[model samples]
Target: MKEYKPSFLFRNAHVNTCFPTFFRKVEIEYRRQRVLLRKDDFLDFDWVEKGNSKIIVLCHGLEGSSQSHYIKAFSRYFSERSWDVLALNYRSCSKEPNPSPFFYVAGKGDEIATALKLTSEYQEVVLIGFSLGANKVLDYLGKEEKIPKNVKMGVAVSPPCDLKESSLLFSKGWNRIYEQYFLKQLKRKVIEKEKKYPNILKEIGISIEKVQKATSLVEFDHLVTSQLAGCSDAYDYYEKNSSLFHLRKIHHPTLILTALDDPMMSEHCYPREEVKNNVWLHLETPQYGGHISYASFEKEYWLEKFVFETVNQFQNRK
Candidate 1:
């Protein structure tokens, strides 16, 4: 049931990954809500609620804000259908920096849960996450022992569920291009945070210079992410936090969409056996959907349409 129809030219993995990012234009008005987390940090959530009983929460990829093309596309489609949609921006993903020195880099559900708290308790909820956001969705669902009764389903696209293995894969070959770009972006954030909270990294036993000097994803994680997450190092952070380990614990009717050719994905993240054993977890590999990129000629996209249908199916049963 998880099928995707793609445009021919976007069939190539690289093309699928890059085309929408550069060319696609989607604009939608949002009523922005700045939420204060318990830790004193604030997150920006963009809302398009149309007084609907059902709502979809959209989580974007690494360094992606609520303005990401895929997120905007999803918001527009769902909102037009009379389904409320809220896109939550991660700390520092918004216009302002969070008061906390650290940003959530791994698949921790803390921030996602915080955002969900803003929603009406009586409304049915669907959570959709892409790439790094996908990992967070899966982790949040699996790790939380007490899922809200109103939260019905979840969707994860291009999730690098196995963080350690995927980070290693991200360091090699053409993947390095993305790796470099992301590193540049993340470094800029670290600099911003450092300027706002001087010696913040030092207090945590890491230097801003060291974080800026890191070349690979693993090194950067080792310096910052691991420390922030309270792990020994990057490997430990990945080992403990990767959503792959938490899939079996998920209770909701969840869907995972991963491209077979996705650059950083490995077998650890896409285990057939795990999905087979869990009726709640549905896995769909579309041969080449290319890391959250689905090229489409139609105004109604394959990714969004399929997810809506899937969610509809689940909601009907409820």
Candidate 2:
């Protein structure tokens, strides 16, 4: 073999190599706190507050929490800049299950709107989300209801803009890794729900064992996720909730970052000309960054720099 370059070695390293060590460091460093959004038995949001100036709500992806690496890094970055952050954990994600019968989805902007109502009381708000969280943020913005007066802008990273494309992408080659990982977590969560609501599981005629054996995200969604959550089917859920359909309605300054190599999303997910003139939407399509992977040489990766700088620029412009 030719002499291995340092960067090349770093990129492809297995076991305890640069990539593994980086993820470990990221996991350990980003501290998060569990917070309750409601008092009695409603939904709770896990939040971590940093800095001072305005409030920024950070939303985690499917089956993710406030403790995710990206959430921690972004929180630290914004906090240091005098911007406070609240990372909202979707319904059952924080630690325990949510009390309500319903959970959050890409279209259920109510929970987020509720969180924003609480946070926006003190400072101007900026919404940032990754993966599934990003899709919901976009959907929230696309809604006709009046957003809080303080929300200035929004940012979405590796968003599954088009659910139809995303679902198909997850079914292919190396992308199966992401699909499998998500399916595992989702299946586990569903089983956990089964234990809590045995009647609901029986009513849907789905066994937890079948959920565990699911081969694809769509299969799992069709059998368990949609029924447990009260949707007609996976197709109905995808069609009704996908953010891509409502992109034209986005009114705020939004920065959407996606990668061509993102296994979980398709190349067609990047819509260059779909951006309307009214919405200050910036779409950045880099060549690398698998899913939300933003590996780099310096301490700060390109995605981090782009998100921080973009938000700062937008905030300052106001």
Candidate 3:
């Protein structure tokens, strides 16, 4: 493993001092904003429209809204560069309750595909996603369908590319906290879904308490998430949705940044050599940045700047 040059010293100071302002700006841009889509009731986005070309569509992780700290940070960074930045809210994430009976899953890519098509007007389209969203964007671009000419580049941050491994990781002791946190949110959504589609909810035997007490992702998916998304079972969904298998098909200029210490995912899930020969694929693994928490300073962080600088460098080159 190559040593990451310590850029955190100066960058951390700046991020710590400025992250508050940065966060405020993100809140102003993302608060209560919604972009409704025509495809599914579950689809919508939170947008911060700034520049005309070189659009960056940001997708957040599971149960994470477009207003997530990282999404906001990237929005600020991209907007300053005069780039159009869209912080897309997956189903049930935009504050306003989704009208549909279904929610989203990792690597499903429905909302991403919708957002891409919606932004077809842009000349340069760049897809950037964090965690679950990263895997989705990567998988979508890797499809044999031939990525549209407008999608100039792609970036994935701390992606859980292998669903099976990620789920297994969640079962471990320390990682169980993450599983619990996610399960709490998942159960809430399930309860909301049950209220929206009581008949369907009844058919699936979804109970709020049962889902709330679920210990594993597989259990949650099999009992509530799969049925809600119209899938057969947890295994079937995992087989169809995991993006690890699609690495070979990524043809765009793609950058994948992961941290070895991300508690949400397993170490074995990182596949370095998978896209080694692909000229467009760049994989970066830093020792820190726990699931996008790249705060290396008492306040500021070089990781955010690194992300912006790297994206800008690629954009300029393209």
Candidate 4:
């Protein structure tokens, strides 16, 4: 792994965490495309063309879209490097609401497979997923016996490998702040879904009142996410979906990036033992970098530069 030296002025974890959201500026022009899925559902993709055969597919974190700062930053970085970029937005995550009421979850690898099929024309492809999307990528690679020949490698940043553990952490102090933010967005989406598919919430045994009363992510997941996704409950959902157990089965060359100080994940989220045993997996846990944010005053966003360089190294070695 390349050495990471964070700027001294903003080395504090929280400072590095919050700096980019307020200071970083990313503007990338993209041509939007909607991908139709098998179940009559659709995913929105933002394409930044560089007229190159090599392509990179970016999967954003929970509640994130193509306009996310990290997505835009990487899109611009790879586009400048002459690589085609496709930023996948999960169902209902784009400008238009999805027709189906069911949305994406952390371990929904099938959706990633659907996205990969759409990129068959590219000679080379790399999957880069952040947070929740990262878990989806790892799950997909592990479960599939064979991956697309064009997909060379994958990079997952700050993934919640163990969904149950991460959920427990989110219900506690400080972490509750993050939980509340996510819950607000999720609730809004659920309400929107209710408007289009009125029977969805009823079918899942979740009422609009119960959803409005949700105070934590755990409660929300149990009441809505788990039911809508066909799990018995939140625990069952986490048990079936968490990527930690699937890590050992991955055959593709993959890099996992996380930080010891990441507020969103518990220590269990880092699969150090699994990575040590798996030849295909590479793990890097820096001393700092909160969640997906790895900002430095000098570089503004260190994660973007690190990912670009690491991916390039992987490409050259391949």
Candidate 4 structure lDDT: 0.85
State the lDDT of candidate 4 residue by residue for 1-318, as single tens digits: 555667775567667666777888889999998777656588788898867999889999989999988899889888888799989888878966677767888895566787788789999999999999899888888878768999988899999999999999998877777788899999998888888777766775788889899998889989888887889989999988999989999888899999888888888899999999999999999887877887765543678778888888888886
**TM-score, candidate number 1:** 0.95
Listing every candidate in turn, what is its Cα RMSD in Å to the true structure after a full C-alpha superposition? 1.6, 4.7, 4.3, 1.7
Cα lDDT of model 1 by residue, 129-242, tens digit: 999999999999989887788898999998889988998988888899999999999888888887888876678787888888999888999888888888899999998888
- Give per-residue lDDT, candidate 1, residue 194: 79
Off by over 4 Å in 2: 1-24, 27-41, 204-209, 276-278
- Count of clashing pairs, candidate 4: 0
In candidate 4, the residue pairs with backbone N, CA or C atoms under 3 Å apart (3 or more residues apart, or in different chains) clash, namely none
* Candidate 1 segments whose C-alpha is farther than 4 A from its true place: none
Q: List TM-scores for all candidates, in order.
A: 0.95, 0.85, 0.85, 0.95
How many residue pairs clash in model 2?
3
Higher-ranked by TM-score: 2 or 4? 4
lDDT of candidate 3 over 221-293, digit per residue (tens): 8877667666787877877788888888778888888876677767655878786766768888876556665
Q: How many residue pairs clash in model 3?
A: 4
Candidate 2 on 1-318: residue-level lDDT in tens? 011123543333221122522453353233344345565235556554554658788888887777777777777666767777777777777777664444567664566787776686656888898988988888888874788878888888888888767887788876676678778887777777667766555564766677777799888877776775567878887887888877788888888888665667776577676674545688877655656655655554556667888777776787
